[model samples]
Target: MNVPLRDPNIVMKLSRLGSFHQSKLSFLRSFLKEFKDWDYKRDLFELNEHGYGIAVYSFKKKNRVYSLICFANELDENERSDRVIATKWDAAFTLFDGVPAKQDIERLKNEVPKQEFGRLSFKELTLSRANKSVRIFNHVVESLSKGVQPDRELLDKVGYLYRTTAVYGSGKFGLADRFRIKDRKEIYGPFRLEMMLVYLVRQFTFDQVNHVAKNKNPKKAVKLDPEICRNLGIGNSTGLGMAPFIVNHPTLLNNWISARETSLKKIREIKNISNEEIELFLGCLKKSIKNITSWNTESEYQIKKIKSLLSDLNKFIMYLDKEFNFKQDFAFNEMYLDLEKNYCEECIEYVVSMMMEPFDDIVTPLIQEMSSEEGKYFNIPTERTVAELKAILENKYSEILNIDFSKKENNLNFWFISKNKEEPRLANRFDENGADLEQPLAIARDVKKLYDLLSVSKNSWTIAKFLSTNNELRHVVRRAFIVEKFPYSEIQDNTIGQEIMPIDMLRLKLSFFGALKFDPRSDKWLRICMFQGAPLPEQLKNYDEHWVYN
Candidate 1:
């Protein structure tokens, strides 16, 4: 039996996209799978008693090597901040393309810590900076120095010892442009190098904490248990800087959503399900609930969503355990329909992620398809008639056309780049001073304006002639043509609406990064934990493939 892919109109809405969860196709999980057989090593470790020095970790297979050079620094309590404007952090790092020599290390030590002000060479693939969770870091050090493990309750509450505020790659700063390394077979997936940087950073936290503890008390200090080490992952504090990424990279975003929808469609088409597959699906679903229950957040918006998700998940579990039958034909398809009819969007998406866990064959191949050559779709088809562009807009942007952009609430917010950090920011258009310089991120509003103009123009006029007259809508015109081919390319909602939750955009991107336990601090920024339940680097070889659910 063939099952239709979920409608892009329904799936591309910000709320539904925001409800997405990490699956087998998440870049981090796929990164681990790709590098599992490669050699893993701590190539360099030269830290002082205070854990203020240089460390290096590498993943080498044959002649290729990607080394993560880490520099741990001592920062006073007042110097540490997670905002993008902050200049100092507890640690800074860069993933070197090849192994670094003594001179290279010295060169990076000076610049990596300087962060945005520092210049990096093409040898650097990615640059990032992290601040320690001082309270948690100090508690762990004190506990380990006394020959005791830190409180698991405290560890679980915060989830990581350090939280990176930014991870930069793809020509940001002076890092190597993606064109230089895009052909690498191992890193064909999107953000694989970024994932590597964060995963290695996780190990650095463990090594740094252990090193500091041993130095505090050499006699009684004990190494942190490997189990505890595996439980702690790296944390990230993300802000409005991430929102523009999805809007600016339309083809890349479509590839991601397309891969996901394709995986779901293929899984739903399976007619016969084995007992093992059924057992695996149910087991993962049951075990993953711990992730939701332990999720700590102060934002009432997130709190309410979590409550609804948990409540709906419980109801679905009860139905699955009591009424569902594995013997039924196209069982997953039935399950999906039932989920959409009865559960909330959050629960439906949660179960959608779980469904992929039991079917690696369906998801593994799609991982490579998530990256896009966006340049191929950039040029608008100006040769087509004006009528063609109007029809594409009307069909592809049905819901978007209905939005009343003239209303104050519809045009309430504007997105602009900050002068200080050169990062994306959102503000009220009426109250703020920079609406005139607003970025072209309001796709829905602009598309509606394009439609109104198109409705008044002659149907037979070519797009080239129309664009020659109305050049202001060129960006949306380019997007409209692209969206005609890529259904999930455009977000089917008003981005500048007053009720917009910027964190929803962040969450959409983070979910693809395999982040868990999203803790939104506000509508604009959030904290997330990565690799919390993942295997340690040493255990990568011969590790359980489904360790995420373990």
Candidate 2:
């Protein structure tokens, strides 16, 4: 069968894209899979008993070494917060390009914690920080000091010892530009260093807890169980800050989704599935129930979705067990059809994820397709005629064109960078100031405007000529042509619409990061856990390929 991939329009709906789950194609999982055989070590651990000091951890293979230099500080409980506004964190971390010297650590110790305000040099690859989940951290310390593990239920409820507010890479805060290390085979996967930073931070959390416990009473203290340690992963608090990332990195977004859709297309084309692969896929689908049930969320929105997803999943599993036969050719295709008819978006996407679980031969290659050199597509094809551009807007942005931006609800919000932190923020265009300085995120409205303007222009006029008079829609014009090639690159809805759920954008990016257990705090932000069930760095050499499902 020579099947073209699924249409990007159906796959790129904000809700459908948001329903995505991590697979072997997820960046973090792929990163671990790619770098498993590289060396892992604690190159430096110089923190005091109070955990106020510097530490360096490294993963080296041959001549290359990526070191994570960490600085732990004693913050007043009041000083610790998970908001982007927070200036002080209990800990700050950076992935150095190579092993750092004492002088390098000393300079970084002063600036790294300052975050966005800090000036990082070219030697750094990525920067990030995490505030202690005080309740869990203190409880774990108290329990271990008394020689006991903390309750798994309480620990699982929060899912991590620390929650990172932001993980900055690719030139944010003056870090080494991505051009510096884009070619390194070890990190060709997107967010690999960020994953490594979070992974190492998970280790740091364990080490910090163990250190505090040992200091409290060396004789009575016991180490945290490795099993419990494995269960805990790094937590991340994401907000509207992540939403524009997808909008800005269109080709990157296309690569990620294309990898997923390509995997699905390949799986559907499989003619013969061995009994073992079928068993593995079903096993993962069944075991993943824990991820859903234990998925605690206070958002009534997510709660209802989860309830519906669980119900649909149960129904689909029953149908598979009672009615479906793997002996049939195109069995996975039939299963997918049943899922689409009988399941919620959540359950259908969930099953799609499970279907990929048994096909590494298919999934592994797609993993490499996820990362993109966005700059390659950054320049507009300004030589093209106005007619070609209009056709693209009409075809690719047909749904978007119907939105009447003159309505207050359609033009409800404007995305801007917060003056203080330079982070992304959404504000009312009429009520709040700075709409004049609005970031180029309102593609739907702008593309519609571009279409209206194009209607009056000469069809033979080049984009360069049109842009000379319409520079404001330059961003969306560039995007219209891009969407011609990468249909999944643009969201089909008006992002500034009153009904927009900004977290949907965040969830799309998080899913690609291999994050699990999204806990949305509001329509604008959410908390998620990463690498919760992943192998520890030491065990990466020979680890479970199905760790995400585990």
In order, what lDDT does every prediction score? Answer: 0.93, 0.87
lDDT of 1: 0.93
Residues 1-550, model 2: lDDT tens digits: 5557877667888888788887778878888888898899998888787777888888889999989988898999878777788889999999998889889988898899898888999999899988888889999999999998889999989989988888889888889998988888778788888988988888988888999998987999998998899899988888888899899888888888888888888888887789998999999988888889999899998898889888988888888899899979888887887787877788888888889988988988777677887777878988999999888887888777888999999999999999886679999888988999988898888888999999999999999999999998888887887888887888888889888889889888888899878888888888899989888888999898987767
| Residue lDDT tens for model 1, 1-550 | 7788888899999999899999898999999999999999999999999999999999999999999999999899889888888999999999999999999999999999998899999999999999999999999999999999999999989999999998999998899999999999999999999999999999999999999999999999998889989889999888899998999899999999999999999999999999999999999999988889999999899999999999999989999999999789999999999999999999999999999998988999999999999988888887899899989988999888899988999999999999987789899999989899999999999999999999999999999899898999999999999998889888888899998988889989999999987899888999899999889998999988888877
How high is the lDDT of residue 455 in model 2? 99
Off by over 4 Å in 2: 420-422, 430-434
Residue 306 in candidate 2, Cα distance off native in Å:
0.6
Question: Largest TM-score belongs to which candidate?
Answer: 1
- Candidate 2 yields a Cα-based lDDT of 0.87
Lowest summed lDDT window (length 10), candidate 1: 1-10
